[model samples]
Target: MAIELETETADGDDFVVYNHVAPPLSELDMQVIKSVPPGGNWADIPLSIAQKSKRIMQIRKSGGRTTYYGRLRNDLPSYTVSTYFYRPGNGSFVHPEQDRMISVREAARLQSFFDEHRFLGPASSQYKQVGNAVPPLLGRAVGVTIPSGFAVDLFCGAGGLSHGLR
Candidate 1:
């Protein structure tokens, strides 16, 4: 599996997608992603169909993790975006509509990262940056409670609180 960026005018959203790229994926990876439905996971794939995959077959034998090969649910909140989001086998990373992993920008959006906060690195590093981020939205939520005081930020995780408080 790999992370590939695709750009489109985000409909009814504040973000514009661009700087698209790909990490490259094998045919098997694409097939597995295509097999999942919105809100579906590895269990949705029949054993007969996924048999060609050693990992998938092993998952079947061991009983699957809910996060494994999961697709996003359009109507629901997203699951946590971990560093493993780049791979379909690792988390609920598949796009709700497209038969591919969610792009870096999309994952950033999930983390409430603004469009201007560009990630500068290889595709894997970009994915890592987005996945490990502490969302500005969450920080903003915390900031809301402080009312007014000497805000002392002790733990800095990408200046999320500072961004939100700004």
Candidate 2:
């Protein structure tokens, strides 16, 4: 979710600026957020909690890939956004310092959205939009490298590449 930014109007009038609202996280999710450190993951969680968690048990039983509870590093670009980013076990979608999953607005910024680009939808839908979006920075770099005037996007969910070209 987006945070509010205070700003004044150009005509020297008082105005509340950059209105934003983030969905609140649940208590359990908050606990997990506080326990995990930047760039850390489920590995960083206390052994007691980790062992007791159902996700861990399922991972051990299945032997499938389990990088769940991955955290992000503030100093570097984050890992690719995944479709199921709300689930910590899905990808490195946690906030670097905040004890929570990165907000929808934060995810959007990572994908090269300016603060003005407001996402309109329920929290889950907003997340899906951000997760599916191409990183605008990557799109710009690739678009410039490509030697074509006309561009065609087969499944442009959020138009990151199209925005870059524009």
Lowest summed lDDT window (length 10), candidate 2: 15-24
On residues 57-112, what C-alpha lDDT tens digit does candidate 2 reach at each position?
56655654525677788798788776676667677777676556667666777788
The estimated TM-scores of all candidates read 0.75, 0.68
Each prediction's Cα lDDT score?
A: 0.79, 0.68
Off by over 4 Å in 1: 1-16, 147-166
Q: How much is 67 displaced in model 1, in angstroms?
A: 1.6
Error (Å) of candidate 1 at residue 149 is: 4.8
Model 1 TM-score is 0.75
> Best-fitting candidate, measured by lDDT?
1
Per residue, candidate 1 scores C-alpha lDDT tens digits across 72-119 of 988999999998787889989888987777777788888998766788
Model 2 error, position 4 (Å): 7.3
For model 1, the run of ten residues with the poorest summed lDDT:
1-10
Q: Candidate 2 versus the native: TM-score?
A: 0.68
Task: Report clash pairs, candidate 1.
Answer: none
